[model samples]
Target: MLINEGNTNVFIVTDAVLNKLGIPAKVTDYLDAKNISYHVYDGITPDPTFNVVEEGLRQSIAANCDAIIAIGGGSVIDAAKMIAMSQGNKCKPQQLIGILKARKPSAPLYCVPTTAGTGSEATLGAVISDDKTHQKALSIDPRMVPLAAAIDPIIMKGMPAHITADTGIDVLTHALEAWMSANASVETDYYAASAVKSVMHYLPLAYKDGGNLKAREEMGIAAHYGGIAFNKAGLGYVHAIAHQLGAYYSIPSWSC
Candidate 1:
């Protein structure tokens, strides 16, 4: 099922922790077995900055990557989206903000989420840092959405309790805020309600037993649903305030 004669060099953007934990290595091993050429850039930090995006972009361009496969949490995937699309646009990540009116389409992108939150794989928005202004800016464009998402529950079994809790909360926040947003539609409401129900039913089990595949799957599905809901309905004060907190304290968005 390798597409385009397997000439697409998949650029995997991830964090050092996941790389050290061997997730990227395992994925690379599989890709190698399938004779798919790929490269891994594990330099993306938590709450990534524009500089980090630029670094990944440089590597991707040098590798002549035709596609991107992000294999970590939201930060890694967010950075990958920027890297995947930056090849077509010369502007910096910050300057590409405010609805992404300036960006052109780029290579196909895929996401493999190791964590069951953030839902960056399903969304079209990426938050990049503006170092000069000490603020975070949103890059919003349908072109930023990944062409496919691989939601593997086995990969999420390694998440610690705190990560599970925080990400679960993030999912809840996304659903509720989306449901109540002024832009909410019937389609979004259905997805939001389903996400809320799944989080309430499975988050505690996933937190208590990280290896529970059922709970992990539910959370992962809920996260994706929440992402889809919010992408259409938009988020409210919670996300806006959280963005400010991330910018003000240099904290990760999930932490807020």
Candidate 2:
């Protein structure tokens, strides 16, 4: 399917933890079976910085990869967005930090999120942190959304309990804020309500038993719905304050 879309040579973006855990093998193993040409960049860190995206871009360029696939959580996906946009524009990742900074389309990007958090695959914005200061900058462009996203429960089944709980709350928060936003429309309200309903019912089950595939899949959908809702209706103070807290404490934004 990717090949039909002109993704002949692919670059995979992931993080060290997921790489070490071999979680990305779910996709890589399939690629191997298909004899697809690809390269893996496992340098993405929590709250990835411009330096991280730059290195990923360098590796992708060196490999002559024509497409990009992100596998892992929000940080990895956000970094991949920068890499894809930068590679497509043939520019530095830092140059694409502001809204609508890209003059051209991003590289054809696909995602297989390993965590049910952040909903980055469904969003057009990516956050990149400063290496030293840890301050975050967002880049927004419709082109940044992935061409495809696979929310497989099998891939998310191994997430730790704490992360599951934190991220489930993240989904709920996104939905609640979007529902309450002044920009909320019928479409946003529908998505936000669906997300809230899913989170309220499935989050506890997923947290208590990560192996619950149904719960995992539902939570993933909730996250996606939350992203769609907030992408149109906008977020509120919870995210604003949480983002700053995360930066100050060097914790995951969801945890804040």
Candidate 3:
């Protein structure tokens, strides 16, 4: 992902998981080579909370970042979306919940997915947690979609067996749920069916051997198709129930 600014800095919001996975260093190396000024806030937790979004917003503003680049899994990208949109809204992140009206637009945003699930890079929605109410809050706006997305297979190669299994299930859920949604159209169904077939054939292989490039490539394409399907057709009960499970159990949405 490239963030262009005329002498202004760029901000990155990411989860600690990607730091542990050593992806951030790679990104920083490239930024350094390009002489880009940047700061990384890697404190975003799993199933990000409103406070987490607020913190990232504060950091982004403090750094005088004109653009935002998010690198990591869904949580990181979700947090970035919240941060980017919250720039002009003076209200707290929790206050923005259910208030679709916007006073100002957000900064340019870019995404680099380190995992093959969630597909937050391609979607217009960001799911955040209201820690006070113990409920999940969703922010949906087309402006929240990243201006660009970088899907490099090398970034997904480090996924462990458990993450691979869970994220693969997430890919399947996106496809199936989109197919069953009330808004599904002919184009949505075609993409959803293709995603289903690809996930069914390649998820297990990718999970079994993380270094399998062909399987990883297939899985990546499946995730993109699933994203496109759901982005147009919307999702149904499976996602609703899964969100409940994540909120109730304090687990990752990709996890059972």
Candidate 4:
């Protein structure tokens, strides 16, 4: 509806995860009902690379998209951030890595997370891989955060059991690491603790029954809290080492 108010030409960023599960139907339906034109770039891999970002950008530009909607797991969100950032800054994904190098704001970004992990939809950073070596790169800028998000448990209901378990642990890890950070302020600690409590109470339920909308919704909220907490407090050794391994292994951020 927000997109409907504007004459927005949208680029849909996602991966095989959502496509296989047919989660994009609602999105297409909403856009179609509004007579909105869109292009789907469902080519994102597990750990997105510079090439992936470039490919997405190519499609976006080809379609003359003015906005983006990411609709899958962490990798999908990460790729969306890179694609949007590249579109706005008019640079390669490799050029934007490390700290805040973005000279301008990214295209208006939105997310519809299919998994309650990474919380990338709410974060200011995206981890992208190199085009050549498959090594990871960190692109951090305030503009990378999505302007809005859709955490619909109905779409998240189709996640596999293993993914549900892994992503739930990912949420807990984010909260735990944030709570243990040296810069943990009262505000951040509160968010971290709340996220931890929510994950403890709801993750198992969600894992056991992916169809449980209440549990799925709670986990989604918890993941968001963890993202906010970490963004404020900063993580410690675990995240540092994990980042290294993730870069070296070229694995998904959630797995790390």
Error of 1 at 40 (Å): 0.9
lDDT of predicted model 2: 0.92
Judge candidate 4 against the unseen true structure and give its global Cα lDDT, from 0 to 1: 0.87
Candidate 1 local lDDT, 1-256, one digit each (tens): 3365355577888899998999888678878887788988999987788999998888888988877888898888888888877765755565667786554785678888998888889999888877667688788899989888888889999999999999999999999999999999999999999999999999999999999999999999999999999999999888888888887788877798
Looking at model 3, which ten-residue stretch has the lowest summed lDDT?
Answer: 1-10
TM-score of 2: 0.97
- Judging by lDDT, tell me the better candidate of 2 and 4: 2
Candidate 4 similarity to native, TM-score? 0.95
RMSD of each: 1.5, 1.0, 1.7, 1.4
What local lDDT does model 3 show for residue 117? Answer: 83
What does candidate 3's lDDT look like per residue over 1-256, in tens digits?
Answer: 3533353477888887787777888878887888888999999998999889989998988888888889988899989988888875655666556546556676778888878888788887889977877678998777778888888778888889889889989999999999999999999999899989999999989999999878888887788789889988998888888788887778898885
Over the full model, what C-alpha lDDT does candidate 3 score relative to the true structure? 0.84
List the candidates ranked by lDDT, beginning with the highest.
Answer: 2, 4, 1, 3
Q: Considering only N, C-alpha and C atoms within 3 Å, which residue pairs clash in candidate 4? A: none
lDDT of each: 0.86, 0.92, 0.84, 0.87
Better of 2 and 3 by lDDT: 2
Better of 2 and 4 by TM-score: 2
lDDT of 4 by residue, 135-251 (tens): 678889998999999889988888888899888888888899999999899999999999999999998899889999999999998989999999888877776777667767877
